[model samples]
Target: MSEIVIRTASARQGDIARRAEAMGVDDVFISDLVETFYARVQANETLGPVFEAAIGDEWTPHLHTMKQFWSSIALNAGTYGGRPIPAHHKHLDKIKSEHFSIWLALFAQTLHDIAPSPEAAAFFLERAERIGENFQSILFK
Candidate 1:
Protein backbone atom coordinates (compact mmCIF):
# COMPACT_ATOMS: atom_id res chain seq x y z
CA MET A 1 0.00 0.00 0.00
CA SER A 2 1.18 3.52 -0.78
CA GLU A 3 1.39 6.22 1.81
CA ILE A 4 -1.55 8.62 1.82
CA VAL A 5 -1.43 12.35 2.26
CA ILE A 6 -3.93 14.66 3.90
CA ARG A 7 -4.34 18.36 3.18
CA THR A 8 -5.92 20.86 5.57
CA ALA A 9 -6.51 23.72 3.18
CA SER A 10 -9.88 24.91 1.98
CA ALA A 11 -10.71 25.50 -1.66
CA ARG A 12 -12.36 28.78 -2.46
CA GLN A 13 -15.42 27.11 -3.96
CA GLY A 14 -15.83 23.49 -2.88
CA ASP A 15 -15.23 24.11 0.79
CA ILE A 16 -17.63 27.00 0.72
CA ALA A 17 -20.40 24.81 -0.61
CA ARG A 18 -19.59 22.06 1.81
CA ARG A 19 -19.48 24.32 4.83
CA ALA A 20 -22.54 26.19 3.71
CA GLU A 21 -24.53 22.98 3.24
CA ALA A 22 -23.41 21.74 6.62
CA MET A 23 -24.59 25.01 8.09
CA GLY A 24 -27.95 24.35 6.43
CA VAL A 25 -27.26 27.06 3.91
CA ASP A 26 -28.65 25.04 1.03
CA ASP A 27 -31.84 24.21 2.90
CA VAL A 28 -32.22 27.17 5.23
CA PHE A 29 -30.04 30.01 3.96
CA ILE A 30 -32.66 31.78 1.90
CA SER A 31 -35.40 31.72 4.52
CA ASP A 32 -33.02 32.95 7.15
CA LEU A 33 -31.93 35.75 4.88
CA VAL A 34 -35.52 36.63 4.06
CA GLU A 35 -36.64 36.53 7.66
CA THR A 36 -33.83 38.86 8.68
CA PHE A 37 -34.43 41.11 5.73
CA TYR A 38 -38.13 41.29 6.44
CA ALA A 39 -37.55 42.12 10.07
CA ARG A 40 -35.41 45.07 9.02
CA VAL A 41 -37.93 46.04 6.39
CA GLN A 42 -40.74 45.88 8.90
CA ALA A 43 -38.87 48.11 11.29
CA ASN A 44 -37.86 50.74 8.78
CA GLU A 45 -39.84 53.93 8.88
CA THR A 46 -40.16 54.08 5.12
CA LEU A 47 -40.88 50.45 4.26
CA GLY A 48 -41.90 48.62 7.43
CA PRO A 49 -45.68 48.86 7.41
CA VAL A 50 -45.87 48.29 3.68
CA PHE A 51 -44.24 44.88 3.84
CA GLU A 52 -46.30 43.84 6.83
CA ALA A 53 -49.51 44.64 5.00
CA ALA A 54 -48.71 43.50 1.46
CA ILE A 55 -46.77 40.42 2.50
CA GLY A 56 -49.76 39.00 4.40
CA ASP A 57 -50.82 35.46 3.47
CA GLU A 58 -47.84 35.30 1.13
CA TRP A 59 -45.09 34.26 3.55
CA THR A 60 -44.90 30.51 3.04
CA PRO A 61 -45.21 30.53 -0.73
CA HIS A 62 -42.79 33.41 -0.94
CA LEU A 63 -40.28 31.65 1.31
CA HIS A 64 -40.59 28.50 -0.79
CA THR A 65 -39.91 30.45 -3.95
CA MET A 66 -36.93 32.17 -2.34
CA LYS A 67 -35.44 28.82 -1.26
CA GLN A 68 -35.81 27.53 -4.79
CA PHE A 69 -34.21 30.69 -6.05
CA TRP A 70 -31.22 30.40 -3.71
CA SER A 71 -30.73 26.67 -4.27
CA SER A 72 -30.72 27.21 -7.99
CA ILE A 73 -28.12 29.95 -7.66
CA ALA A 74 -25.91 28.36 -5.02
CA LEU A 75 -26.17 24.71 -6.04
CA ASN A 76 -26.92 24.68 -9.76
CA ALA A 77 -30.31 23.16 -8.93
CA GLY A 78 -32.15 25.02 -11.72
CA THR A 79 -35.27 25.16 -9.59
CA TYR A 80 -36.23 28.76 -10.17
CA GLY A 81 -37.20 30.78 -13.23
CA GLY A 82 -40.28 32.68 -12.27
CA ARG A 83 -40.78 36.32 -13.16
CA PRO A 84 -40.16 37.88 -9.78
CA ILE A 85 -39.97 41.35 -11.21
CA PRO A 86 -43.73 41.63 -11.17
CA ALA A 87 -43.98 40.18 -7.71
CA HIS A 88 -41.59 42.80 -6.42
CA HIS A 89 -42.86 45.60 -8.57
CA LYS A 90 -45.88 45.93 -6.37
CA HIS A 91 -43.73 46.23 -3.26
CA LEU A 92 -41.38 48.69 -4.89
CA ASP A 93 -44.25 51.07 -5.08
CA LYS A 94 -44.02 51.52 -1.35
CA ILE A 95 -40.29 51.24 -0.72
CA LYS A 96 -37.35 53.57 -1.04
CA SER A 97 -34.17 52.81 -2.93
CA GLU A 98 -32.33 52.57 0.37
CA HIS A 99 -34.49 49.62 1.37
CA PHE A 100 -32.60 47.40 -1.05
CA SER A 101 -29.33 48.42 0.54
CA ILE A 102 -30.57 47.41 3.94
CA TRP A 103 -31.69 44.09 2.57
CA LEU A 104 -28.32 43.43 0.97
CA ALA A 105 -26.43 44.40 4.10
CA LEU A 106 -28.49 42.14 6.31
CA PHE A 107 -28.28 39.27 3.82
CA ALA A 108 -24.51 39.58 3.53
CA GLN A 109 -24.11 39.69 7.28
CA THR A 110 -26.27 36.63 7.81
CA LEU A 111 -24.52 34.60 5.12
CA HIS A 112 -21.13 35.67 6.39
CA ASP A 113 -21.92 34.13 9.75
CA ILE A 114 -22.72 30.75 8.16
CA ALA A 115 -20.46 30.76 5.13
CA PRO A 116 -17.26 28.72 5.35
CA SER A 117 -15.13 30.59 2.85
CA PRO A 118 -14.46 34.15 1.89
CA GLU A 119 -15.33 33.12 -1.63
CA ALA A 120 -18.61 31.64 -0.53
CA ALA A 121 -19.46 34.67 1.54
CA ALA A 122 -18.41 36.84 -1.36
CA PHE A 123 -20.47 34.78 -3.78
CA PHE A 124 -23.60 35.04 -1.66
CA LEU A 125 -23.15 38.74 -1.00
CA GLU A 126 -22.38 39.47 -4.63
CA ARG A 127 -25.58 37.74 -5.67
CA ALA A 128 -27.56 39.71 -3.13
CA GLU A 129 -26.00 42.93 -4.40
CA ARG A 130 -26.81 42.02 -7.97
CA ILE A 131 -30.38 41.12 -7.14
CA GLY A 132 -30.90 44.30 -5.19
CA GLU A 133 -29.47 46.40 -7.98
CA ASN A 134 -31.41 44.61 -10.69
CA PHE A 135 -34.69 44.73 -8.84
CA GLN A 136 -34.29 48.38 -7.97
CA SER A 137 -33.31 49.30 -11.50
CA ILE A 138 -36.09 47.42 -13.21
CA LEU A 139 -38.72 48.61 -10.79
CA PHE A 140 -37.53 52.09 -9.93
CA LYS A 141 -36.04 53.02 -13.26
Candidate 2:
Protein backbone atom coordinates (compact mmCIF):
# COMPACT_ATOMS: atom_id res chain seq x y z
CA MET A 1 0.00 0.00 0.00
CA SER A 2 2.76 2.43 0.88
CA GLU A 3 4.61 1.62 -2.32
CA ILE A 4 1.47 2.19 -4.34
CA VAL A 5 0.92 5.51 -2.65
CA ILE A 6 4.47 6.55 -3.36
CA ARG A 7 4.12 5.65 -7.01
CA THR A 8 0.90 7.59 -7.24
CA ALA A 9 2.57 10.66 -5.76
CA SER A 10 5.49 10.22 -8.14
CA ALA A 11 3.16 9.99 -11.08
CA ARG A 12 1.42 13.18 -10.01
CA GLN A 13 4.79 14.88 -9.78
CA GLY A 14 5.58 13.76 -13.31
CA ASP A 15 2.40 15.37 -14.50
CA ILE A 16 3.35 18.57 -12.74
CA ALA A 17 6.75 18.51 -14.40
CA ARG A 18 5.20 18.08 -17.85
CA ARG A 19 2.79 20.93 -17.19
CA ALA A 20 5.58 23.12 -15.89
CA GLU A 21 7.54 22.41 -19.06
CA ALA A 22 4.74 23.98 -21.04
CA MET A 23 5.26 27.34 -19.34
CA GLY A 24 8.96 26.95 -18.64
CA VAL A 25 7.76 26.30 -15.10
CA ASP A 26 5.03 24.30 -13.57
CA ASP A 27 2.23 26.67 -12.58
CA VAL A 28 1.23 24.19 -9.94
CA PHE A 29 4.80 24.24 -8.69
CA ILE A 30 4.79 28.00 -8.37
CA SER A 31 1.40 27.96 -6.74
CA ASP A 32 2.55 25.36 -4.25
CA LEU A 33 5.69 27.32 -3.51
CA VAL A 34 3.71 30.49 -2.85
CA GLU A 35 1.12 28.69 -0.80
CA THR A 36 3.71 26.96 1.35
CA PHE A 37 5.83 30.07 1.72
CA TYR A 38 2.94 32.23 2.90
CA ALA A 39 1.77 29.58 5.25
CA ARG A 40 5.17 29.88 6.86
CA VAL A 41 4.90 33.65 6.88
CA GLN A 42 1.50 33.45 8.54
CA ALA A 43 2.84 31.02 11.12
CA ASN A 44 6.06 32.92 11.67
CA GLU A 45 6.03 34.72 15.01
CA THR A 46 7.42 37.97 13.70
CA LEU A 47 5.94 38.08 10.22
CA GLY A 48 2.64 36.37 11.00
CA PRO A 49 0.88 39.04 13.02
CA VAL A 50 2.10 41.81 10.80
CA PHE A 51 0.65 40.00 7.79
CA GLU A 52 -2.48 38.90 9.61
CA ALA A 53 -3.18 42.48 10.58
CA ALA A 54 -2.49 43.68 7.08
CA ILE A 55 -4.35 40.86 5.38
CA GLY A 56 -7.18 40.10 7.84
CA ASP A 57 -9.90 38.08 6.12
CA GLU A 58 -8.55 38.85 2.69
CA TRP A 59 -6.08 36.00 2.55
CA THR A 60 -7.90 34.21 -0.22
CA PRO A 61 -7.89 37.20 -2.51
CA HIS A 62 -4.39 38.09 -1.43
CA LEU A 63 -3.06 34.64 -2.25
CA HIS A 64 -4.71 34.70 -5.64
CA THR A 65 -3.13 38.05 -6.36
CA MET A 66 0.23 36.78 -5.24
CA LYS A 67 0.01 33.72 -7.47
CA GLN A 68 -0.73 36.01 -10.36
CA PHE A 69 2.23 38.15 -9.40
CA TRP A 70 4.57 35.18 -9.38
CA SER A 71 3.16 33.85 -12.62
CA SER A 72 3.86 37.18 -14.23
CA ILE A 73 7.36 37.24 -12.91
CA ALA A 74 8.35 33.64 -13.55
CA LEU A 75 6.58 32.85 -16.77
CA ASN A 76 6.20 36.33 -18.25
CA ALA A 77 2.53 35.42 -18.46
CA GLY A 78 1.27 38.94 -17.76
CA THR A 79 -1.17 37.54 -15.29
CA TYR A 80 -0.88 40.21 -12.58
CA GLY A 81 -1.76 43.87 -13.01
CA GLY A 82 -1.61 45.38 -9.53
CA ARG A 83 1.01 47.85 -8.44
CA PRO A 84 3.07 46.19 -5.74
CA ILE A 85 4.53 49.39 -4.38
CA PRO A 86 1.22 50.91 -3.36
CA ALA A 87 0.06 47.58 -2.08
CA HIS A 88 3.04 47.40 0.24
CA HIS A 89 2.87 51.05 1.20
CA LYS A 90 0.45 50.32 3.98
CA HIS A 91 3.05 48.12 5.67
CA LEU A 92 5.83 50.66 5.31
CA ASP A 93 5.37 51.83 8.85
CA LYS A 94 5.68 48.28 10.15
CA ILE A 95 8.33 46.88 7.85
CA LYS A 96 12.00 47.21 8.60
CA SER A 97 15.36 45.88 7.45
CA GLU A 98 15.01 42.90 9.71
CA HIS A 99 11.55 42.21 8.38
CA PHE A 100 12.84 42.21 4.84
CA SER A 101 15.62 39.88 5.90
CA ILE A 102 13.11 37.55 7.45
CA TRP A 103 10.97 37.77 4.35
CA LEU A 104 13.90 36.90 2.11
CA ALA A 105 14.94 34.05 4.34
CA LEU A 106 11.44 32.62 4.32
CA PHE A 107 11.31 33.01 0.57
CA ALA A 108 14.63 31.27 0.17
CA GLN A 109 13.36 28.46 2.31
CA THR A 110 10.28 28.20 0.17
CA LEU A 111 12.31 27.99 -3.00
CA HIS A 112 14.50 25.40 -1.43
CA ASP A 113 11.48 23.42 -0.38
CA ILE A 114 9.65 23.38 -3.70
CA ALA A 115 11.83 24.49 -6.61
CA PRO A 116 12.42 21.93 -9.34
CA SER A 117 16.18 22.36 -9.18
CA PRO A 118 18.91 24.32 -7.45
CA GLU A 119 19.36 26.46 -10.53
CA ALA A 120 15.64 27.05 -10.65
CA ALA A 121 15.63 27.99 -6.96
CA ALA A 122 18.51 30.38 -7.50
CA PHE A 123 16.70 32.03 -10.39
CA PHE A 124 13.67 32.66 -8.22
CA LEU A 125 15.81 33.81 -5.30
CA GLU A 126 17.65 36.34 -7.42
CA ARG A 127 14.40 37.95 -8.48
CA ALA A 128 12.99 37.77 -4.96
CA GLU A 129 16.07 39.38 -3.45
CA ARG A 130 15.97 42.14 -6.00
CA ILE A 131 12.32 42.76 -5.32
CA GLY A 132 12.92 42.80 -1.60
CA GLU A 133 15.77 45.27 -1.99
CA ASN A 134 13.66 47.51 -4.17
CA PHE A 135 10.86 47.49 -1.66
CA GLN A 136 13.23 48.22 1.21
CA SER A 137 14.97 51.06 -0.54
CA ILE A 138 11.71 52.67 -1.61
CA LEU A 139 10.07 52.25 1.77
CA PHE A 140 13.03 53.32 3.90
CA LYS A 141 14.44 56.00 1.65
Candidate 3:
Protein backbone atom coordinates (compact mmCIF):
# COMPACT_ATOMS: atom_id res chain seq x y z
CA MET A 1 0.00 0.00 0.00
CA SER A 2 1.01 3.60 -0.51
CA GLU A 3 2.43 5.54 2.39
CA ILE A 4 -0.53 7.84 2.37
CA VAL A 5 -2.97 4.99 2.70
CA ILE A 6 -0.87 3.37 5.39
CA ARG A 7 -0.61 6.63 7.34
CA THR A 8 -4.32 7.27 6.96
CA ALA A 9 -5.15 3.83 8.25
CA SER A 10 -2.80 4.25 11.14
CA ALA A 11 -4.33 7.62 12.02
CA ARG A 12 -7.80 6.16 11.78
CA GLN A 13 -6.89 3.22 13.94
CA GLY A 14 -5.55 5.56 16.56
CA ASP A 15 -8.73 7.55 16.28
CA ILE A 16 -10.90 4.51 16.78
CA ALA A 17 -8.90 3.50 19.80
CA ARG A 18 -9.05 6.97 21.26
CA ARG A 19 -12.81 7.19 20.64
CA ALA A 20 -14.67 10.23 22.11
CA GLU A 21 -11.55 12.41 21.96
CA ALA A 22 -12.06 13.37 18.33
CA MET A 23 -15.42 15.17 18.43
CA GLY A 24 -17.55 13.44 20.97
CA VAL A 25 -19.17 11.38 18.20
CA ASP A 26 -20.22 7.83 18.89
CA ASP A 27 -21.45 4.76 17.01
CA VAL A 28 -25.14 5.35 17.71
CA PHE A 29 -25.04 8.88 16.34
CA ILE A 30 -23.36 7.72 13.16
CA SER A 31 -25.90 4.94 12.79
CA ASP A 32 -28.80 7.33 13.19
CA LEU A 33 -27.31 9.76 10.70
CA VAL A 34 -26.77 7.08 8.06
CA GLU A 35 -30.19 5.54 8.56
CA THR A 36 -32.03 8.85 8.49
CA PHE A 37 -30.14 10.14 5.45
CA TYR A 38 -30.74 6.93 3.50
CA ALA A 39 -34.40 6.96 4.40
CA ARG A 40 -34.68 10.46 3.06
CA VAL A 41 -32.82 9.41 -0.07
CA GLN A 42 -35.24 6.55 -0.62
CA ALA A 43 -38.22 8.90 -0.44
CA ASN A 44 -36.71 11.65 -2.52
CA GLU A 45 -38.10 11.80 -6.03
CA THR A 46 -34.85 12.84 -7.66
CA LEU A 47 -32.41 10.60 -5.84
CA GLY A 48 -34.66 7.66 -5.09
CA PRO A 49 -34.69 6.28 -8.61
CA VAL A 50 -30.92 6.34 -9.02
CA PHE A 51 -30.29 4.76 -5.66
CA GLU A 52 -33.06 2.23 -6.15
CA ALA A 53 -31.61 1.13 -9.44
CA ALA A 54 -28.13 0.86 -8.01
CA ILE A 55 -29.17 -0.69 -4.72
CA GLY A 56 -32.40 -2.52 -5.57
CA ASP A 57 -33.23 -5.26 -3.06
CA GLU A 58 -29.81 -4.99 -1.44
CA TRP A 59 -30.85 -2.35 1.03
CA THR A 60 -29.80 -4.42 4.00
CA PRO A 61 -26.27 -4.81 2.72
CA HIS A 62 -26.22 -1.22 1.55
CA LEU A 63 -27.42 0.05 4.87
CA HIS A 64 -24.82 -1.96 6.67
CA THR A 65 -22.18 -0.58 4.38
CA MET A 66 -23.42 2.94 4.87
CA LYS A 67 -23.36 2.56 8.61
CA GLN A 68 -19.81 1.36 8.39
CA PHE A 69 -18.94 4.14 5.97
CA TRP A 70 -20.25 6.93 8.15
CA SER A 71 -18.75 5.35 11.19
CA SER A 72 -15.44 5.31 9.40
CA ILE A 73 -15.80 8.94 8.51
CA ALA A 74 -17.24 10.30 11.72
CA LEU A 75 -15.41 8.08 14.17
CA ASN A 76 -12.50 6.82 12.11
CA ALA A 77 -13.63 3.36 13.21
CA GLY A 78 -11.96 1.69 10.23
CA THR A 79 -15.12 -0.36 9.95
CA TYR A 80 -15.40 0.30 6.23
CA GLY A 81 -12.73 -0.47 3.67
CA GLY A 82 -14.45 0.12 0.36
CA ARG A 83 -13.41 2.79 -2.07
CA PRO A 84 -16.13 5.44 -2.51
CA ILE A 85 -14.65 7.10 -5.59
CA PRO A 86 -14.97 4.05 -7.82
CA ALA A 87 -18.33 3.29 -6.32
CA HIS A 88 -19.65 6.71 -7.25
CA HIS A 89 -17.83 6.60 -10.53
CA LYS A 90 -19.92 3.62 -11.56
CA HIS A 91 -22.99 5.87 -11.39
CA LEU A 92 -21.41 8.86 -13.09
CA ASP A 93 -23.99 8.78 -15.88
CA LYS A 94 -26.78 9.10 -13.36
CA ILE A 95 -25.13 11.77 -11.22
CA LYS A 96 -25.22 15.51 -11.82
CA SER A 97 -24.44 18.78 -10.06
CA GLU A 98 -27.98 19.09 -8.86
CA HIS A 99 -27.84 15.58 -7.47
CA PHE A 100 -24.88 16.56 -5.31
CA SER A 101 -26.71 19.65 -4.17
CA ILE A 102 -29.70 17.59 -3.17
CA TRP A 103 -27.46 15.07 -1.46
CA LEU A 104 -25.63 17.74 0.54
CA ALA A 105 -28.92 19.34 1.46
CA LEU A 106 -30.34 16.09 2.71
CA PHE A 107 -27.11 15.27 4.51
CA ALA A 108 -27.07 18.65 6.21
CA GLN A 109 -30.67 18.25 7.19
CA THR A 110 -30.09 14.78 8.52
CA LEU A 111 -27.19 16.06 10.59
CA HIS A 112 -29.30 18.88 11.92
CA ASP A 113 -32.11 16.52 12.77
CA ILE A 114 -30.02 13.86 14.44
CA ALA A 115 -26.53 15.08 15.26
CA PRO A 116 -25.48 15.10 18.87
CA SER A 117 -24.31 18.69 18.75
CA PRO A 118 -23.80 21.64 16.46
CA GLU A 119 -20.09 20.97 16.30
CA ALA A 120 -20.74 17.39 15.32
CA ALA A 121 -23.09 18.51 12.58
CA ALA A 122 -20.57 21.01 11.31
CA PHE A 123 -17.82 18.44 11.43
CA PHE A 124 -19.74 15.96 9.33
CA LEU A 125 -21.03 18.63 6.97
CA GLU A 126 -17.55 19.90 6.29
CA ARG A 127 -16.40 16.40 5.40
CA ALA A 128 -19.51 15.76 3.34
CA GLU A 129 -19.03 18.96 1.38
CA ARG A 130 -15.42 18.10 0.65
CA ILE A 131 -16.36 14.61 -0.47
CA GLY A 132 -19.13 15.96 -2.69
CA GLU A 133 -16.78 18.45 -4.25
CA ASN A 134 -14.20 15.77 -4.95
CA PHE A 135 -16.81 13.50 -6.50
CA GLN A 136 -18.17 16.30 -8.62
CA SER A 137 -14.76 17.18 -9.95
CA ILE A 138 -14.01 13.61 -10.89
CA LEU A 139 -17.42 12.94 -12.37
CA PHE A 140 -17.69 16.16 -14.32
CA LYS A 141 -14.12 16.79 -15.31
Residue 93 CA displacement from its true place in model 2, Å: 2.6
- The models' CA-based lDDT, in order, is 0.71, 0.83, 0.84
Tens-digit lDDT string for candidate 2 (32-56): 9889999999999999998988899
* TM-score per candidate, chains pooled: 0.69, 0.82, 0.83
lDDT of 3 by residue, 1-141 (tens): 656544676786776646544555887777778889999999999999989988889998999998898887766667899888888888867877789999999999998888777888898899999998998898788
Best by lDDT: 3
Superior by TM-score: candidate 1 or candidate 2? 2
In TM-score terms, candidate 3 sits at 0.83
Model 1 gets an lDDT of: 0.71
- Kindly report which residue stretches of model 3 are placed more than 4 angstroms away from their true locations once superposed: 1-24
- Kindly report which residue stretches of model 1 are placed more than 4 angstroms away from their true locations once superposed: 1-25, 28-47
Better of 2 and 3 by lDDT: 3
Query: Candidate 1's residue-wise lDDT over 41-109, tens digit each?
Result: 667766667666778767777677777888778865668988888877777657778777776766777
